[model samples]
Target: MNSVFTEDTKTGDIIIQFPAASKLFKEYKIDFCCGGNRPIGEVIKSQQLEDKDLIKVLNIMYEQMQTTEEIDWMTMPLTDLVNHIIHHYHAKTRDLLEELSAFVSKVYRVHGERDSHLKEVYTQFFLLKDELEQHLLGEEQRIFPKVMEYDLNNSLETLEEARAEINILEKEHEGAGDILKKIRQATNDYELPMDACNTYRLTYLKLEELESLTFDHIHLENNVLFRRL
Candidate 1:
């Protein structure tokens, strides 16, 4: 069927042009990052997803983008956004993960008998922590550097390579998302049990914060930075 949204329009282009589309893509579990170059209509058809609902969400979000309180990363320079990811999200995540690691460990040790989910939470968090540390290192050492190079010189080859690395990074993001989901499920959406101690409460709160920050971090990179290429 012929749609108002052109078949050839790249999903990345759509999201980059309308940041709010990221939320819709997320709601639909569309891989806008790894498959960013694919045509939007093709993605929908290939996934057997209904295009009408997707188009409706995209339209609503595009309108909201005009007046949303969110930062319009589309207008911001790639380098500046990269710096924000590094200093604002990456660095903060590193520190938070470290503290959470110790906190979760202590809480599990102290309270695991009362609530068995703490053990799972403790295990999943460390997995996420390790994965995130490596993910951050990869971005800093390789991905971000290549992006900076492409930004400076506009090398098509470098851009292609960066896009490939971004696909891998997006898979990593999915893995991290799974771990966060497990934690949330185990903890009942970070809800404190009737007997949850101070440390237990703090651990759950911190995990929720980590989830929120990570979502924002992934959104900015996947939606804004990568689309420019």
Candidate 2:
């Protein structure tokens, strides 16, 4: 297989080929699980990321993987995994959501009339923000604690409790994902109008970030956590 990473390659395809891309995608907050069909350039531009920086990181990751072992999600301690998700993914996403919400609100206040989609996008963003806030709470309060208990005691009872919480979390994940799809459809995949200003572009970029974060959140809970339970 050719090891050269190409900018023209689809982000999801690259992830499928290079397992290391999964880690990079997680670092960049890029979606490779659900929303992995788009090209790397399109995903990067939509998120307003510096394409050169992303490519540089990808190349380095690819080179490093030649000698490095893939990360084993299952074998990692549950406490460490929970802490990692909370400190890295949840905390960063909460900050991003707050910033994006304010950005959308400003755009709506300033340009809602000129661009009607601003109001629509703003509403969708608020819905997603609220849902994610609650979702994170559930994980922190209910799911993560149970996982940690299981790790400490190695008890089937703790594992059972974790499984119960995970079921609810999975449903919430699906609901959030549905809302993201609606937002993408409403904005024509974050396509901006001809008269869009900087804030409009920022809103789309934030949506891309949210999309990526949500996928990572769900992937951790669904693929990694659930398997542990």
Candidate 3:
């Protein structure tokens, strides 16, 4: 059994192979979602991270994860996968977005004049929140049903619809990823200023949490579920 993940490995494929790999990728600030189709080496080179032992660490993490009892979405039934995406990612993310919206607004309103980036962060977040809310709804109402139906009956017609919907959703994922990145940049990776209050701190922290969750959400759909479809 080869336990090594080299630079040649596809970023998305790694997440499909080991969902837990997203944690390592997130920790390294490496993208394994929208750019998941690219090789790990491309990002490492572009980011000037060639000196880091990313491949070695990734291989080690993969080897370790093998010993743990984790749900392998790659081989799971499509219905099970869809349900997990809804329950695990969708429901929780909706709550998180709702929970953060007020704070995002407050932070921008109170501090926008003091720091221009706060305005950018505010604008980007609302854009993300709106886009994601619609995205989740689309998945639950449109594509996911087709996937579930195809899984149950293996209907060619349903499969065709699911494929088309998945393509559209993928493009939306790319756009959402771009907005999230812009927000991260505007917030300076969610660094709080010296005079920051509790609301400001909480806003930044939650926003960062949202970013992490969104990345994992996109990874599961793009790398794992969509491939199965």
Between candidates 2 and 3, the one scoring higher on lDDT is 3
| True-structure RMSD, every candidate | 5.1, 7.0, 1.5
Predicted candidate 1 versus true structure: per-residue lDDT over 177-210, tens digit per residue: 7888799889877778788778878888888889
Better of 1 and 3 by lDDT: 3
> In what order do the candidates fall by lDDT, top score first?
3, 1, 2
Global lDDT scores for all candidate models:
0.79, 0.77, 0.87
- Tens-place lDDT per residue, model 3, 100-187, is 9999899888988998888888888888999999999999999999999999999999999999988899999999999989998888
Poorest stretch of ten by lDDT in candidate 1? 1-10
- TM-score per model over all chains: 0.73, 0.73, 0.95
Model 3 regions more than 4 Å off: 1-3
What is the RMSD, in Å, between candidate 2 and the native fold over all Cα? 7.0
